[model samples]
Target chain A: METSSPRPRAERARQVADVLRQRITAGAFDDGPLPDEHTLGTQLGATRNAVREALGLLRAEGLVERRQGVGTLVVHPKYGHGLDRLVGLAEALDGYGDVVNEVRSVGIVTPPPATAERLGLVPGAPAVHLERLRRLGGVPLSLDTTYLTADIGVPLLDHDLAGRDLFALIEETSGRRLGRADVVVHAVTAGPDTAALLDVAPGTAVFALDRLTHLDDGRPVDAETLHIRADRLTLRATLHRGPA
Target chain B: METSSPRPRAERARQVADVLRQRITAGAFDDGPLPDEHTLGTQLGATRNAVREALGLLRAEGLVERRQGVGTLVVHPKYGHGLDRLVGLAEALDGYGDVVNEVRSVGIVTPPPATAERLGLVPGAPAVHLERLRRLGGVPLSLDTTYLTADIGVPLLDHDLAGRDLFALIEETSGRRLGRADVVVHAVTAGPDTAALLDVAPGTAVFALDRLTHLDDGRPVDAETLHIRADRLTLRATLHRGPA
Candidate 1:
């Protein structure tokens, strides 16, 4: 949304910024730091001022960060999501590398009245509560909390989650695979606990994904709340006019 | 994300809050105020304090607002976008009633270098730019900025918007139907201008949707930026195994 009339000299900086934007979006620095401004200037044959301006624009866009001694680090190259995928968050970021599931806790807890209602159980009934931090390359991506009814909850927590997917593990333990989920998406600000785990300031905007996963027999198997850091990830959804 | 052991007395308030959340998410009060504390208590058969706490939770969740003299007002009842609808911002909120498109400005100007590039035009080439504030029931919902290439831009601006969809008008004026768009979604903070128009505090989190719409012949025809108030909008996207 530039308002001033454009000048030819500014083209150099614009071009530099455009190429950098492409690299950031392509996940080129998924695990590494971006090139230093001096290096970019030399390689692109642009002035140091041009490279500086380009990097400044990127920082404003929240794509990269400059630490005191860390130099210029690509803080978050967008997590590009296609609009048709229905996979789990772990599966969605598999291509980005180092999708680590850090299980904070696994135990039976009295379900929240809302969670019980969602799972069609008595209020305050016991349920399997799994709290996890999904990290990519050691940087936390999301806080995932999954609640399962007693039948599935009891067996699922008995086994430690190996390298297998969470959904796959639930299937193995409960002897039933979840078929589908009714999902609700919310744009919310992170609270104290969630903000701490995601390494964002409290009240930072986040994406809250609430899902009720059901079994093949149509019994509600699990209710999950995925709180995703908005700066680190982006999601797409398709809108169809009428039913196909 | 509650930690304390559940108390029996809290159950009543929790139930009250749960029902309120459902109504907010369903856009049940798009243009009205939520019932007052005493009224809610009478309706839900809960104590007044319980109603107060329930409303407090909804406020923290950014659903309802407690105006001093206006009582509790529903602020950001999530705008559930199903994803496939290609309708304009006005049409998208038609269900909410009285979607007003207030054009802030419309004129020809030198496009931002990046926007010009996307439109396949030389730097500083003239393009029609339109800035608008979308209001639902006199409440501002989003700030929309649309840029049209000269071929379509010149003719489109000659007439009033006249309750027409921007894309539909582009096709009417240029005789070319637009096709797909490459959309980039960003969870960003609103700047002073946008924050003021949406009547929200400055730096409030918002959703930045930048889209480059193309013609059936694969020619990029328009570039638009829509800044939606997070308090008012919720977007959903899907994920799949591999590239579709």
Candidate 2:
């Protein structure tokens, strides 16, 4: 579709975004507010239009906090969940130790057909279900609902989760070591019920992650569906490229 | 974020959602409307209340689209771009060749400072800028704004892009083979200008991708920022895991 080129405004914004991103990362304005539009434009020899555009990009990247009356302030560090390893919510939210886990429920129930098939169970088989809410500094961060087949889940239900480490509990009860896991990350709007739990409006975009873990012998041990607040969390990963 | 454990209604909804998802994916109602609430409840042995809750989940996933009076119909196939490769938009949308390219503008301009730095150019150096709109079946699909430095970008300016393949033109004109690219994918809301361009309402969620491509010898060749409608496309990737 060949038509007229885009307006120069966007190009200018890209330039601003690039420069500001570096300055922020290099700690030029460490823990400080960004200069006003006039000052910043003068300092960078960029038009105020460009600087404003750049700030929008930075805010979209979750790099700065912009308030109407308050100046543009650098937001405090946020949690970064790495995609390379199998990390739990507690481990992912490490820098912020002011975290708590509230186990909402635990019981045995008929497994969903798809999940039952994944766990190599009969269609009507019962599975152990666990629902837990993870909070950071008393604010909801994520809600995790996990399904485990009875062989391992039954033992897990009998164990106390005062510590809230489901993996450890599963390993101890099932006597199986987690070998590897497959994680699928995608986005979904919060349903009414999820919105109430996560303290967000219904239809707000959220990170929906599904994880399937396996035992050393290649047995599926556990499956978890985790819904995380997108605003408070950013998942990071490096996609390596090699010669074709 | 301690609050009520969420209503039992949520739990019931999830159970319904889970069962219905399997049915849909299994082609139980392929290309057809889902059974009405009463019919569905009777078939799955679930309460009508739960069936209604489940439909909401399906609607959000774009699996089954709802109409005011007609009925809920299954959506057609969707595109899934893999993150593992550096695929041009034209190549990614090859299955639908009816897509037209509208080049917004083409010219030499002052390189945005940060982009200049990344491209190894001195500050204020001129770069080639190309803005384009991509439409599929006469419907706007994405907006692409690309930045190319002069040394390589100049020669390609004279080449014809009637085929809508800029990468090929660049390769032929610059005499350089494409190597690898690093792409970052994230979500952002469509601001006023962007919304108008893509024909979407303001604040609609869109997928933003930033790609930096390099030459065979590791020289940066092009940098592009592409905005795509999320509801129209989903990026798929298989994340492999091993011990760190």
Candidate 3:
């Protein structure tokens, strides 16, 4: 719906695109191709021009594609990853497909200063360093690099990392449950190495998550940095207002 | 810290950059310029070559800059916004600076289909629409477009929107305590118009937040789309792990 005052065409297009994007992601068009621009315009009570512009925006986002004769089609579907829960990639994407971890590297090494601090490791102490290329349904989703305290990390080196989540392995090995995590989420342009791993063009926007996970006793044990493909994952949260 | 096996130089640089970026954002360099590459390399237990490349990476991210005569300097400080809490921009950046809202437009209008559905308005029902350019310390931070149910939104026009957050005004006007919000966060390239408003170049990566806030009784009242400058804000959260 248009505002009372005249707004820029681009803004109007964005509004329409927002609505269409939500509907597309919600599987409104799973049965068949999307309606024509004229139909979408009438359905959303937007101008035909705005609807066309909105479709163009969606096309650029790689969510939908315009075919010469097949009409508009939903090209990619993004999976929602809940940010309120401290879950592993496999647990988070449960029911989507089997999340396979390709363990690129795993060894005992010196962690960076910040990682060492987060994991509460003593200076000069060795920690387990693990690098994984995580995939869902055979498509790369994230590149995860993790540092763990030596006590628990050393045991994980012998576990089946590809078939199970690290959280599970940590608990099984140390008998300590994961309690919580402090996470920082930001957008970063994909570098050449990351882009190659995630199979995206260099400079594409991706979600960078830096997290420090703690044991149930409040001892930090895991520090991870994850570069997730933005087009494939959406971070979701339900937040409550605290006292002012 | 280097792994036991040799890794790519670029990957090593990224690891160093991550640690340095965290330290920079934590105000580790407030007293002076960053240490020389050799000193930093020793501090982080990385090679001088990797430290040099790390500084280069930070320079590209606009987090740090290297001067010809002077040393590296932290260019921009990012404000961390708690994603676990439902608060206005002003509240999120309380200690940073005064968050001023520049109301670009406010009026009653027909909302898009999804907006109307989210707000639970009947077909053809009117809702209050607001567009605000939010700034921190006189610099643009976010572009907020909001839609509210008519019952709570109609009276907001008379409130001091520019000086106060909408959450405060909504509660004051509707006499309804706000409860929770559903938020979705992702990254998008800024369009030409949005880039102009946020004083960034076109195609700059920005955080796009879509939120639907509800009243204490679970009635959704406010729906918003926020385009936040990525360099100026970082989203933080403390997440708990649920039972397996």
Model 2 chain A lowest lDDT segment of ten: A235-244
| Collision count for each candidate, in order | 9, 14, 0
What does the lDDT come to for candidate 3? 0.83
Can you rank all candidates by TM-score, best first?
3, 2, 1
In CAPRI terms, where does candidate 3 land?
A: medium
* Model 2, residue B143: C-alpha shift (Å): 2.8
Docking class for model 2 is acceptable
Please tell me the TM-score of chain B in candidate 1 relative to the true structure's chain B. Answer: 0.74
**Top candidate by lDDT:** 3
TM-score of chain A taken by itself, candidate 2? 0.79
Among these predictions, the greatest TM-score belongs to 3
Worst 10 residues of 3 chain A by lDDT: A1-10
Residue range B50-87, candidate 1, lDDT tens digits: 78877775576667888888889886567765455455
Candidate 3, what DockQ?
0.56
C-alpha positional error of residue A200 in candidate 3 after TM-score superposition, expressed in Å? 1.1
